[model samples]
Target: MAKKKYDYSPNDFVVYPAHGVGKVVSIETQEIAGFELEMFVIAFEKDKMTLRVPTNKAEEVGMRSLASTDVVADCMKTLRGKAKVKKAMWSRRAQEYEQKINSGDLIAIAEVVRDLHRADDQREQSYSERQLYEAALERLTREFAAVGNGNELEAGTEITDTLQSRVSAA
Candidate 1:
């Protein structure tokens, strides 16, 4: 695998696709499968989880630093834009939504959240839909929290409200 080109180092805050934000605790060389591998051990304090990403595969796995304020601003703006709800079958739309959430692109994740969000007056969502929505919401909120230097609850509320208000207005 080719080396990743990143401006970040150990102890940096980065967003891992599908997993949310984590801090690079250390860069270690470990012997795995009879070969020495250089990897970054990232700790997700919020989820009490850790990830070891091979240095070369970090980019391929969507490991990236927190977006700059301007970038984050644009992502949040995406939430308020028109929801491109497709008129496809539920299964088809569900798969597409899952892919967007897992892609770990904040803007794409925000779109999923915005599209699935139903306001207080809207009909109740199915259990599966709720699960998917919650997953996408949590994923987006964690990254937003890291970027805003806030806690999970705070970040979640902000993103949810922003998205909900937009969808409600539609």
Candidate 2:
């Protein structure tokens, strides 16, 4: 058998679109339906969940390595930009926000966070709005933390500080 090439190796952090940041624990070959298949075993520490993804299907499932520093910088710039709240109905907006969070694009997730965020003095978000905001914030911070070599709490503080500064300046 020829050696197989894989994009990720053991102990590497990866981002799964629907999930967030997870570590690739190992790659294993297993027999299913009498055929051997190689899979990537990923462990999501925060969620306390483990996922096995077929090696060939990882990219198709939107599993990717963490963002680069340049991408993280772009996400910060996006957070500082003005929020583009639409005039659509709340349900529609919420659906859009959920999609952005699950898209696993750092910039798109940052946009969702920026758009949904309310300043301390601003009106309080509705229960659903608050839920969406928190979801987006978590996804963004997790990836940010992984890329920046910091914990999620530090990343959350840095991100919120950026938002706060932007609000104050405005």
C-alpha lDDT of all candidate models, in order: 0.84, 0.94
Model 1, 22-123: lDDT tens digits are 899888889999999988899988689999999889888888888788877887888888778899998999999999988878888888887888788878
**Stretches > 4 Å off in candidate 2:** none
* Clashing pairs in model 1, backbone N/Cα/C closer than 3 A: none
For residues 39-147, write the lDDT of model 2, one tens digit per residue: 9999999899999999999999999999999999999999999989999999999999999899988899999999999998999899999999999999999999998
Candidate closest to the true structure, highest lDDT: 2
Clashes of each: 0, 0
Residue 140 accuracy (lDDT) in model 2? 94
Q: Per-residue error at 95 for model 2, in Å?
A: 0.9
